[model samples]
Target chain A: MSTSIVPSERAADRGALAAPLDDGPRQREARAGRRRSATRIALGGALPILLIALWYAATAFDWVPAHKLPSPDAVIVAGIDLWERGLLGMHITISVQRVLLGFAIGAAAGLVIGAIVGLSRFADGVLAPTVGAVRAVPSLAWVPLLILYLGFGEDSKVTLVAIGALFPVYTTVAGALRHVDPHLVEMGRAYGYTRSRLLLTVQLPAVIPAIISGLRLALAQAWLFLVAAELVGSTMGLGFLLIESQGNLRYDRLFLAILALGVIGKTTDALIGIGERALLKRWG
Target chain B: MSLSQRTTTLESPALPVSLRGVGRSFGSGRKELPTTVLRDVDLDVTAGEIVALIGPSGCGKSTLLRQISGLDTPTAGSITIDDRSIAPADQRCAMAFQEPRLLPWRTAARNVQLGLARGLDRARGAERVAELLELVHLSHARDQRPREISGGMAQRVSLARALARGPGVLLLDEPFGALDALTRLSMQDLLVDIHAAEPTTIVFVTHDVDEALILADRVVLLGSEPDLPGATIRRVISVPGSRPRDRADAELGELRAELLDGLGVPSHHSHH
Candidate 1:
């Protein structure tokens, strides 16, 4: 890629000044964003750096017990130990499976109900008010009631995750239909489309972006609720490890559990974002 | 409100559409705050004739075209199309807009085929689509997605689509206004050729006077909202000489000047 042999004068000038060569439009945009993100991340590290400095200072001055606030070095050791023990993978797998299953059930139920509500005044009148009311009640509020029905088991966790996942799906579908462009629908009518065909073709195509957005939010929420639900006397989950480690004063292990949660959550979130970008490229 | 109710008011022959003293004001039962978009309008559009509508921006030309397409009804005066009030089953009119609004996900052939949905059985649909692609000289690009084609090609496909329904009337709302000069001229010539072959009745709306003079059988000018004859200026500029009419022809230049003068737009901004 040396520019010494370049014939063009503009290229020679650009090369002499060391102006960075750019790729295609998409690659150029991605490189620009990557640089910005790197800069921001570097600047953001300063605050955390200061906090770590203060904590180290406080521990060195014997202001607090070392056991109480485990050294960052100890947390790193514990993280490596857990990684070797295979507990990290097992916990993550369980959480992800619960989230996916729960998300699937909620998405299907919510989509059906949302369509019914969107299309029919009768369904809206009968179901919307009740669902709205139920959605207002937090997942924690339902913990006691769910336990009564399904006991302190996977059933209760799945039910709670479903509860958390349902509202986004319902709102997105109903809102999308309500916002479906009338002009597009007019085009459909002019094309001699039947009522059902209008829904299948024009209406569904217009709603796809919103539908994908809803699915992403629901999946993320399901994971959030699954971990929260797992916190309730959970035997073998990241959340259970987190709670149990706290009681045993194994601060390093607790931090490791929390770190594992953050890492896995971040990875799943990134994957969802990547999926959204790829889907939007093809459809949006 | 119903087909039976509208029958009494729908008899006319010369103009396929005639709105007599039409006035429409939309509001939520609040007369004091009514949005009077069109008023006391009388217009006549003869069949198989291209009528170019020229006016200052925001003169309700698009709304008027919508009325002609039977997509909307006038609030006061009666609008009759082919001696029948516009109904849900009416399929005699088709429209093309500024952007070539082809379904992005569908192939070029499928988009043209969308217009022929009325009679398509699987194989026949594909065949009809192929025939239309040939008409637009887009046969080679039939299987390609809309994203794969240039702007001019997309527009040609859109025209083929509008013709797919066998529309007796074609309504174009600034269809080529978005194209570059070269592509625009190409499309204009293509449209003239297509119109000459089939004689599809058209209501072509453009701010370009030369465009109107070249394609229109008559150039009608509507004044600013709240002015009348409702159709303020009407000139029958017969496109009689031939296809590929010389742009330098004295008759065309004169008509273009008159159309620009009528619409009160300077020829320099539009003609060139």
Candidate 2:
């Protein structure tokens, strides 16, 4: 509704400003919109700032033992130490590469299989139940079984991430197909669009908003499975860094690793969010 | 007509349509009871003729139009265009539904180009799209999405899209049904203008008696008495005049009253 209201009001104000009259009202309206958005952003940022302040106070005052909870500055120093030793960047690169590869493989399979199942009732009946059952099992539960077959290698970790990413994309696409407006389908048929043409032009475009959100969910799952995979059986990655630091009782490095995980997770999700916003602006 | 003139018109010929004992029914299978929507309807739409189908709810006006457009088939009858059986892939016909049904993702111009999908080359399709948009007075809204425009503007885009394919038979299912009274009036005028510029055999469906009188060459009322099971052509009243005439014409008022009577609805207006 904010979007709906803003454009029309701006248009009205722009038109009024074109005429020979006072521009005070238009200026005030523009200022009010800016002021409201500013306030909203400030309000949204308040909780995180407050939490960080509490963490800093608790750590700096040694309210929690220094060994148990390191100060923020200590974690920063640990980050600097890793950076100086060239380990931080290497770990991040490895994790990012693994996630990207796994996500690509998963998404490609989901796109094709989801479309087939969505469009064909026979495929839905035959394939859906088996997929649903497999997906219902927790993603991490696959780790041990996959390790047994593929061994503790990059293959097992990447495959685990792929499995995690696949189901969300498939389910979202299939659900979107089912929910497409019947009116649009009728219109397409009336316009003489063949079945394949209808799928590409009308059905696919309509499903995009749903698919973007689904892909974002899948990416989040991919990250989760990556960390877990590394924790169980990897020598190089963020998860490995975390377990290594914990064993050395270097709380600062452990905290640093956790911070890196949070930052990377938020950054990737935000990137997807940005893409979703752009898509919805056009087609949502 | 001269040879050149005749050839020009042949490119987009207004093909005549005929319905023989056209009837449609639904739900005739296991765990489903049969219900008839139309029964033993017979009608003819001459080349370049604009006929309006009007009736109350459950009168099957839309169902009839769908059958004519080859979007649906008759259960117990036949429909033909230029005396040949209608085909599913027939490019000779285009239809507009009660709802505009423009794809929300595409801009108004792109949506219109959807009608030109089959044969026209890319350049020709784009050119035709521009021409059609201008015809419907929507050239200004070419790049705007459906949600950004007003309802009347969106409906005009739908009309332009229907015209983009150069359909010989243009079928409209209450195209102006969703607009307000003022917008509906303007849209009706726009439809008249489009029909004049590009003559096509049109079969329009509406519930408005005045709309039927104002636009159609002939109005077909498709309903029956309360006890009747299915609707047929109760009456086909010919409106005798050129279109773009005054809506307040004395002859149209009288005809409106008579048509209302044919639909079993009493007319309530006082003649001035």
Candidate 3:
């Protein structure tokens, strides 16, 4: 690319030129900005550290009863103990497995539903209202109905997670399709794409960023709902461990379980985000 | 290429679009309150003819293009494409609007491939995509998303997409109007070259008089508000030769003057 811009230029000539290729001060400011943002990100990261430190201090000084609040070290010890017992590993695996299963089911169903709702007027007319009404009801509300119908087992929990997970995928797809530039749709139409090709290629791809967002939300819900669904009805999974700990009033273990859930959720969300950035790089 | 040169017989070919006394009214049919968008719109876009539609905004220029592309039907007349009556799912004619409209989830190359199905097999589709990306000078940004490119580059990819299926007719609605002058000029040159090489029937719409004069074999201007009942055949300017059609020529200036006056803008407004 051409670099450097000569100054003896009038505005008209400058307009004729593309935005300047190079500027010394501009480059310096850009470097300064990179440094500033990097510093800010580093500094901002410490707030969490400070919060943990405060939590430790409050516990160390006995500001609250040990039963009421577990110290950071106590939770860490509990995490280590649970890991040593093989409880943490097994529960994490089960939760991950459950999230993956429910996510796949919900996301697939949601994608199909989204394409239909986005593409077909008849399909949308038939399904959108029903999906809308169903979405209004939280996935937790279905627990009672599922338990009564299928009883407290893995099926109910998985099903609940799937139900919880489905709406976001459905909504993201629908909204994305709705908002997809008519410009692109027109481009698709002009290219002589058949109906199926239009949907699978143009329609589906156009709505994917939307679908990806839904998948992330669905994953979170899938993980979160797994815990809630596992709470009363299960002998396995992290929620069972948490509930069991709560009953015994082993506050440190409860804190550790809760922390583990947060950590897992955050990590999984970050991974999905990574997947999205990768896809955007390739596709976008 | 002229309309008469090409062989347009398809396996299931029928009359493309023959608008018989086709006119459009924008409001309710009751009373005289309906705003007439088009009147006595008698025109037939053949299987392979690039007919440029030029007019002022709100003169139903876009509406006319939409009718031909099957986005809507004329209020009073019928329309067709590839012999079939116009429907929402009709695929005879492809269109690209002013915006690039690339799917953010697909790469620039894949965005162009959105139109390559049925007619183009896998290998050929890949070849067409490569050729089109090259044509648009965007293979370097082929892996980038729409957000990563400039407005002009996105529009180029959009053009590539429109050309992907070897469409019977290609419809463009102010496709390059969004770009800067230099970008617009380059895109115009690229469009002319692609049109020449591929020989696809192209109907390019734009408000720029120079753009219409430069790219189209025939420029059909849509008349304005208070154009009033009877159809106005507002000058069909023809300038056929090569790229960068002589901007200073007397014939072009005369035509530009008349068009600007009809559109109620001063002739000086043409350049800006």
Judged by lDDT, which candidate is best? 2
Top model number, TM-score:
2
Off by over 4 Å in 2: A1-46, B1-11, B225-228, B268-272
Residue A68 of model 1 has an lDDT of 84
Error of 3 at B87 (Å): 7.0
Question: What global local distance difference test value does model 3 have?
Answer: 0.76
Calculate DockQ per candidate and list them: 0.26, 0.55, 0.37
lDDT of 1 at B222: 67
How close to the true structure is residue B232 of candidate 1, measured as C-alpha lDDT? 31
For model 1, report the TM-score of its A chain: 0.79
Best of the two (1, 2) by DockQ: 2
User: How should the candidates be ordered by lDDT, best one leading?
Assistant: 2, 3, 1
Report the Cα lDDT for residue B256, model 3. Answer: 74
lDDT of model 1 at position A63: 80
**Which residue pairs does candidate 3 place in steric collision?**
A190-B94, A190-B95, A283-B106, A283-B107, A284-B144, A284-B145, B14-B83
Query: Which candidate gets the maximum DockQ versus the true structure?
Result: 2
User: B229 in model 3: Cα distance from truth in Å?
Assistant: 3.6
**Each model's lDDT:** 0.75, 0.88, 0.76
Residue pairs clashing in model 1 are none
